[model samples]
Target: MPVELDPVKSAQKRSDYNGIYRLEDLTRLSEAVLSDSGQVDVMLKCTYDEQKLPVMLINAVTDVDVTCERCGQPMPLHIELAATFTPKTMRLEEDLVPSNYAIVEVNDYGLVDLRALIEDELMLEIPLVPKHEVENCAIKEQDMVWGELDKAAYEKPSNPFDVLKSLKNPK
Candidate 1:
């Protein structure tokens, strides 16, 4: 289900939110071959820094179906990720922010979409390139070949500077 919260109020109270969102609900995510049964589980906590800047801590796991780059077969990937988000504020110096935390520019309405934030985080955690384990891949070594020169055929070409050397020597 979608979740929305007031950033200021939630942070002040240090609210704890735990819920599961349907994977189908995230439209902005890259398209993957989804398993019939998959879910996004999340635990979101809101707190304020010493300076009263709102911060969000997220813990989440999601299941997604992805094609194996090697075998071209669909496989399930369990993605686990954690993230920290602080609403950007004029009062908060960027240097004060921890390297691990990401800054978000909250909308003018001061409302945050909890589901969307977590969804975006999970998306980022997904691998840029997905591949099945070598042993698990259906493709065999014989099926694919990387260029390999026969030892006898391996011969080095003359150096590019050879022409200049010969020109100087005139031999």
Candidate 2:
């Protein structure tokens, strides 16, 4: 089942969850993806560290199709997220959290929604300018240039700066 557990309680109990979440369920992610027909494999574990601080470690993997910026064609993209987070509770100060673990806010019920977390991480993994490899892309670097340059521009022998030279040495 989709993970939605109280971080504080889960940490105390040392809970673990592994499952698949539908991409279509993630509204924001679905909108950005080319097709909302995929699943994210999620593995989550909640426990305390050496410092006895409640923390959760999560890993997720998924694939989506994104429009290539270069050719505007659909290209497959893989996403993976592996992160450790410390639950931020009223008693836990942000500064006290360990540097290695990111701080995650708890809901009103002190629960951590794994689906939302996966969605956020997956969104971040998407590239700002998606593109295929140079060899595989339909549009090439050479083809990116605009229409051919005017041959007359380069062939013209007369120098426009000659007028300046004449002004400097008015013979």
Candidate 3:
């Protein structure tokens, strides 16, 4: 079943569910952000504990395409992650501790926004550098050639100053 982040009902009774949440249902996230190649799928399974606080367990998998820094080749990367979230009543600070989980406040009806929570989890899972392993990798031939050329260029010194000094010193 689809879980909507109802701020009212969430505060009433602790709810737990196990299902696949659709990306379209998460209205809080911008469409452009979701369309990005890095995000593939996001799933959440969670429940509210006896204390009337929301507890979310999230599983997210994303596919990213990045260029190799060394070879300038497109690299396919996959990231899989899982985490837990706990809702709290305290006002979150602007610079609080960074965590994969999110805390949602229960409204008068004790409702929590499950969709928003899932979006947050997905955002946190993105990697800083998306790269694949070397050797038998899916790198473009042109990029590999460029990499070799670059390495050769660097290795072959064209230092005019050094050449002049050597000539003058006659060593």
Q: Write the per-residue lDDT of candidate 1 for residues 8-114, one digit (tens) a residue.
A: 67888888888888766776654554553567888888898766668888899877888887788987788897888887766768997888889876667877777
Candidate 2 regions off by >4 Å?
146-171
At residue 101, candidate 3 shows an lDDT of 52
lDDT, candidates in the order shown: 0.77, 0.87, 0.53
Which of the predicted structures, 1 or 2, would earn the higher lDDT when compared with the native? 2
Q: What is model 2's C-alpha RMSD? A: 5.7
> Clashing pairs in model 2?
none
Which number leads on TM-score? 2
lDDT of 3 by residue, 1-171 (tens): 444555324334444454554545544333424234333365555565454445666676655455556555666555576776665545434244246555566455545655565666555665555445656456644455543454566686677798789888985
lDDT of candidate 2 over 1-94, digit per residue (tens): 4556787788899989888899889889989989999998888888999878888898989999999998999999999999998888778877
- Mark the 10 consecutive residues where model 3 has the least summed lDDT: 30-39
Better of 2 and 3 by lDDT: 2
Q: Candidate 1: where are CA atoms >4 Å away?
A: 33-37, 50-52, 147-171
User: What lDDT does candidate 2 reach at residue 132?
Assistant: 97
Best by lDDT: 2
Per-model TM-score, in order, reads 0.77, 0.81, 0.47
